[model samples]
Target: KTTTTSHPASISSTTRGLSAPTASHTRPTGPTGPSEPDPGPGSPFFFLWASPDNPYESESTTTSPPGMVVDNRIFEVLLSLPIWLMVYFCHSNVLDLYRKMPKSHKWAFPWLIHLAMGLAAVVSIVFGYARTHHIAPQDVTGNAFVGLNIISNSERIGLLIFAVVALGKIPETIRSLRSLVGRIAMEVMDIESIMDTTEILEVIASPMLLASATIIALTIRDLAKITDLLGSSSGVLLSLVLPGLVYAAIYSTPYLDIKDHDKRWNGHRLGGFSIATFGVGLGTIGFLATVFSW
Candidate 1:
C-alpha cells in the first residue's frame, strides 16, 4: 500500500491545463446569448427618424404629396384674405359710426352689423355648398345624407337674410354718402381736395360693395363653378392676393384717418393677411385633391 500525494504545483498545473482548453473553446464561438447591434444608419428606427419615408418627418405629411400640402395651404390662406380685410374695414366704419351716434343708438348698431355680417357669411357658405352639390328632394327622406342637405338649405336661408340686411343698409349708406359729399364740396374748391376722408371712404365702400355683389351674384348663378374656382389656384389668387394688395394700400394710406390706424398696422392687418393666406392654402389643397382624384 503506497500513499502517493500529488504536489501542489502538479495539481495546479493539471487544473490550469483543463480550464485553459475549455475557455479557449468557448471564446471562439463568441457570445452565447443574442448580442445587441449598434445603432447604425441601416436601422429601421434610425432611418424612420432621419429619412424622407417617415410621415412624421414633416408637418405636411398629414396630407399626401408633401409639395401639394404646401401649395394648398397657401391657396386657402389667400382665398380668405379679402373677407378678413372687409371685416376689418367694416368694423372700423362701424366704430366710427358708433362714435358719431348718440349713446342710446350706439350699442344696437354694432351688434346689428355684426349679426348681419355673420348671418350673411353663414348663408353664403350654405347656399354655395347646396347649389353646387345639387341635393335631390327624395334624397333627404330617411337618408344618411339628409343632414348635409339640411345644412345646405339652412345656408341658403342664411344667404337670403344676409342679402336682405345688406339691402336694408342701402338707404343709410346713401344718406351718409350724400352728406359726406356735401361737406367735401363746402370745404374745398378742387375736385381732389373736395374728396374728404368720409367721401373717400364712401367711394371705396361703393366699389367694395359692388365687387361683393358681383361675387355673390356669380356664386348664386353657378355655385358649382364658384366652388370649382375657389378650389383653383387662380381663385385663390383672386380671393387673397388682390384683396391683400388693396388692404395694404388702404392700411398704408397716410391721408385716410381711420381710427386705430397704427393698431391695424400692428394687429388687424395681420388678420387680413392671414385670411388671404388661408385662401391660398385651401385652393392649393382643392387643386391637389382634384388632380389626385383624376
Candidate 2:
C-alpha cells in the first residue's frame, strides 16, 4: 500500500486545536498579587502605606466607597507642607549669617534665602513623591536614566546645606523660643502658671517632644536620601537608634526646664536657651523628615 502522510496543513490545524487560546481572548480570574484588604483607622498615609490589612497595597475591595478613591498623596501633601513652613520659619533661626556679612549685603541675602527655600520646597516635593510611590532606591541612580545623577546629588547637597544651617541655628532658636514662651504663656495661660515650677514641669516636656518629633522627621528624611547612595545600614541605625537615645537624653536630663535667655556666652546663663533651642531644632528636624520618609 502507498504510504499515507498527513498534509502539512492538517498537522498545523491539529496543533492549533491543541494549543492554548490567544492572550487577548484570556481573562485572569484572580490578581497576580494578594486580594483586596480590610480598612483601618489612622492617617491616610498609615492606612495606605503602613496598614495591618495590607501595608503598601490597595485594592478594589477596600472599605472606600465605590467610585471614590482617596489619593494618599493628600496625606503626603499634609506631611510635606508643614516642612515648607518650617524652612521658612527656620530662616530666622540660623546662626546670624547676616551679621557676619556686611550690612551692605543685607538686600542680597533675601534673594539667597528665597532661593534656598524654593530649592528646599522643590526637594521636599520630590521626596514626598518618592515616599508615596514607594520608589526603589536603585532606580534613582545609574547612567541609564538621564538627569537622575544630578537630581540625586542635588538632593544630597541640599540636605547637607540645610543640615549645617539647622545645626548652627540651634542655639539662637532655643533662645528665641525661650523668650517667646513667657509671652505666649501670658497671652494664652495665666502668668502664675507660666512661672510655676509644677506648671513648668509640664512645660518642660515640650522640648523632649520637640526632640522626638525632630528625630522622627529629619532622621527619616536623611536616611531616605542617603540610604540608596550609601546603603541602609548606617542610615537606618542613625535614623532609628539615635533619635530614641537623643530623646531619652532630653528626657533624662534635668536642664529641659523652661528658662530665661541671656545674651552673653560666659555665665551660668550660657546654656539658658539650650533646652528650647533643642526643641526648636527638633521641630525643624521633624518637619524635614516629612519631606522624605523611610
Candidate 3:
C-alpha cells in the first residue's frame, strides 16, 4: 500500500534478502475480529489467529472485569489491527522493490519472494500462537522478556523463530528509513540530484536520523502508542487504500500504457474501488480502537 517515487534500487536489496524474516516478525502481533471466528483446521483464515478456544472467553479475574458488557469479543476485534498492518508492511513495499528489478527478473523473483514471505508469516503466526495462547494476556502485557522467559522455561521454539526474524529486520528497517527520508526530500525539494548523491546523503543523514530516532524512542513512555498510531494511519493507507487507488487510476481511461482489454479493466476498476472502501472502514475502526483502548 506504500507509494514511493524514489529510486527503487535503494530498497531492492532489502526486498531480495530481508523479507523472509521480516514477515515472520510481523505475524505474532496480528489481530483478529469478532465476526471471523477461527474456522478450525483446513480453514483458510486459521493461520491468522490462534485456536478458536480463546483463553479470554470466560469471565476471569486476570484477563477481564466481571460482567463486562461486550465480553471477550471486543478484545478479538481490537486485536485484528496487526494482521492488516503486516499486510501493509509487506504489500506496500513490494511494489517499489519490484520496480527496481530488471524486466527479466521482475516477473519471477520479487513475486516468488513475496509469496514465500507471506507463507513464512502465516507459519510464524500459527507457531507463535500455538505455544503462547495458553498464557493469560495479563501475564504477557508489559512484559518485555516474555519471549525470553518462554524460551528458557520450555522446549517450545516459536519464540525462538521470532527472535531470529526480528534480528533480520534490524538492517532492513535502517535502510528503509534512510531511503524513505531521501525520497521525501526529493519530492519536497524537487532535487533530482539528491538521488544521484544518495550515498553521500546517507552518510550525513543516517547519523542524524539515527540520533533523532533514538531521542524520540527515549522520550516516549509507551512505544506501543506510536506503533498503534502508525498502524491505523500509515499502515492502512499504504496496505489497502493506496494500492486500490493506484490500481483504479492506472486502469481507468487509457489504462496507463497497459494494452489490456476493456473487459479486464472494468473488473479491475470495480475491485480497486471495493478495496479502497474497505480500507477506509478498516482504518476508521483501527484508529478508534487505538484511541479508546488507551
Q: Identify the candidate with maximal TM-score.
A: 3
lDDT (10s digit) by residue, model 2, range 1-294:
111111111111111110110000111224463322111111212223342344333332222224332344543443344344344343433323443665466446435434533443343344323322223131221111123344577777986786566555544434433434443344334354455643574477557756854675656554433322221121111222222222222222223212222222123222323433443443344334423333
How many Å off is the CA of 172 in candidate 1?
31
Q: TM-score for candidate 2, please give it.
A: 0.26
Q: Of the candidates numbered 1 and 2, which has the greater lDDT value?
A: 1
Clashing pairs in 3: 1-92, 1-238, 31-79, 31-80, 32-80
In model 2, which regions exceed 4 Å deviation? 1-95, 131-294
By TM-score, rank the candidates, best first: 3, 1, 2
Q: Rate the local accuracy (lDDT) of all candidates.
A: 0.35, 0.32, 0.40
Clashes of each: 32, 3, 5
Q: For each candidate, C-alpha RMSD in Å?
A: 27.9, 20.8, 14.7
lDDT of 3 by residue, 1-294 (tens): 111111111111111111111111111322451121111111112322343443324422222224422323432432343344354443435446545666566446424434533543354343234222322132222112323444353445765575457434544544543454454345336575665667786688668766855764577556445444444544444445555554454444341314453666677667766866776675665557546555
Error of 2 at 166 (Å): 12
Angstrom error at residue 263, model 1: 3.8
What candidate 1 gets wrong by more than 4 Å, as runs, is 1-120, 128-231, 239-241
**How many clashing residue pairs, candidate 2?**
3
**With candidate 2 superimposed using the best TM-score fit, by how many Å does residue 85's alpha carbon deviate from the native?**
13
Best by lDDT: 3
lDDT of 1 by residue, 154-200 (tens): 88787668657755554454444344334334323334444465568
